[model samples]
Target: MPIGDINVPIVGKNVVIAVLVQSHILFAAFIIGAVLIAATSEYMGMVTKQPRYERFARNLARFVVLLFASGAALAITFVLALVTLFPVFFSYLQNIFFWVFLVEAFMFLGQIIIVYAWYNVWDKLAYRKNLHVVFGFIAGFFGLMAMTMIDAVASYMLTPAEAPATDVARTFLNQTMVPLNMHRFVGNFGYAGFLIAGWAGFRYLKSTREDDRAYYDWMGHWGIIWGFGFTMLQPVIGYGYMKGIRESAPDAFDRIMLDNAFTFNLLMIWLTVLAVAATGYFVHKLRFSVRPMPFLRKLAIGGLAFTALFSVLNLIPADGHIATGITFLGGEETQIPLGGMYPWKYIGLIGLMLVGFFVVALYLRASASGFHWGNASRWSQFALIACSVTIVFTMVTMGYTRESARRVDNDPGYLIYKCITLDQKVVSENCPAVSDGVNTISGREAG
Candidate 1:
């Protein structure tokens, strides 16, 4: 078994799949995130009798409707590419997880129907706003289930259940499945929020009307609140997901975390960027307060300095021995890289997060005292735009890391962990009628 012997020379096949899958996930994530925001806004509108929240919700729902078809098309193309390029791998996954696929399909269908219906009848259902809100929840619920089903299947491919029998339930409940689901669930909100904020920021910049500027500015603020808030949960939840990977596939975990230093370092850079962007948004929101807050300003500035330093250190290659004294969380002690190669990233990541937390806390304290949303600087909006770009880049890097981790051994990647491997062999041609000790078919080697 030579390396790549079983793989067909389909040039750019992986890239094609990557682009389609990432695009599909991006669109789908936006829909999920929008649904959440719309639901929340509408509920608050109803409770507070605020027309602005109601209008915002309607606009977002309309936006979701516009993107629905494109998202679906991307999903269809992704599946087609998978089947055409890697039939064996696709079939293997389909056979083992058909039930999950079935559920996902139904949920996806439900989402389409529900989302469109909710969007189309927005004005008609104005009198029955409560019912409309319920429909929104229903649509979100369907979307969540669809996402969960797909995530479980993806997670199973990375860390298959530790069972000999091919029980569908057991396979679906793999160790990493739930954690991945949680991470993605949180990520959906964050990604969606940032994108919305970025759009609002752009609109704010373009608007000539003062009212329009105010509206977009407020909308951007609302989006950032959800975007940054949900993002904060990801580090903790992602740690759990990585722990599952470590437990289920120690080698794969090491390959992602320790062996591939650069990619993990890139992750650190993205995390630092996100930390800075998020904290910067916080500082911007409070920078113009009537009262002086010298302590908080200094804290935020220190955070930026550390983040910038971490980003610089992340650029250093991992082959050489780096100096280290001690490591601690949320301060300076650097170790426990989360799928990262460099040790200092551990410090950078934790410290950045701590700074973000304090920045958020200080903002809350300021809000309680006297800070108002009167007018945020355009520079602050630009910071949010930067956050959106970095978040998207971070997500793409994560996808690349996850996919690359599977093939770290430089052998044929596994379709189901140790049992079914991927390669170039055509299954129909190579499979034998009677089984020998070792069997090779469809690029899969089973014994």
Candidate 2:
């Protein structure tokens, strides 16, 4: 067959699926974060005599359980999609972390048992509240650990290390594993807080009873405090993450960061500023809940506006060159192209990110629309489904973006040629060494 006659795989479709699947993982991450906060708050509430905190904890825990189940289902779909589309990548991962999957399976089963017990026995076992709480904590903790180990195995692939001679333990226990775990853990906490704060605050507004409103407002603010604070520290973890990646694989780090490291670093700088500004807004709104704050509205609106613009500019153009569109008057390469200006992209994306939260906040703000107790609106249920769909699709898109950059012909560009076969024909896709007429792809390739 002519080199061009053989079609390249449908790169975009698989990537789109990958992005959606990724969203599922993120949903799970948020739930894990919520579980920790909810469980921790209640654990402390037990000793502190602060009934409001305990109340907040219970409500929040219920939310976490619901979201986690939804995320788990979504995650299952994501895995199945990966297995179907990218058998090679999946097989590669399974081989390296073979045992961990079994362990994760057990951990998941254990989690279900504990969570159901915890939720079901809220009133049945008052005497063993402490013990019951421990069960939930253990369950959440293991669930997180199992996920984290899997993540470690993944990050290791992106940043592999010098394997010592002999078995040298499992390859999954790579260097960046610990740092990556910490980073992910902190992210989980922060994200959970962000989600719950608005949720609780909304309910507090609708509450007729002064006591209920006060307690809920307090809870909402507290969740934000934890979430926003943890989120603010993301840069620190990110910095360490960069350093670790740099130390481990300077070449890979260089490629990831690019030749213009300082310029690329600008993305984080602007993102931090936006995040801090957002955090201040987060705190101020919750703190000054005596009345609605227009400033918060502007923050959301402005943020969303920026996000839309940024996403437009930064989105993977159907054709992959942000640089081509923005050229200097003269080709000395003196001036930065639009997206070429790093860090500034954050201003755009962070802006777009506001859309979801902004709507969520508004819904919560409309407290006087007459609310019912027990199982919210069909709209709420739909919103959950929407979140799941958006997350999974975006994850898929991300995968496409990454894979398109694979080394083809050892040169750049979509159709660049990589290597020649023994027969001297140009190879369009990457090929393995012809060792004993057997190929060794990192993952098990589908026939």
TM-scores vs. true structure, each candidate: 0.83, 0.63
lDDT of 2 by residue, 1-447 (tens): 432222226665445565665667667776677777877887877887777667776776677677767877876877776565555445545655667677887877777777767777777766777886786698688778777766656555544433411122434565577777787788677666655655664665567786676665555546655655565455557668767766654544544444333323334333433343333343334323445556655665564455445445543221222232433445334444454434545444444345435533553463323122222333332332232233233333333322332322224322111222212343322322112243322111211
| lDDT for each candidate structure | 0.74, 0.52
Q: 174-228, model 1: which lDDT tens digit per residue?
A: 7899999999999999889888888888888888887787788778777887887
Model 1 — TM-score against the truth? 0.83
Q: Tell me the alpha-carbon RMSD of every candidate.
A: 6.4, 9.8
Worst 10 residues of 1 by lDDT: 426-435
Candidate 1 Cα lDDT to native: 0.74
Worst-scoring 10-residue span by lDDT in model 2:
414-423
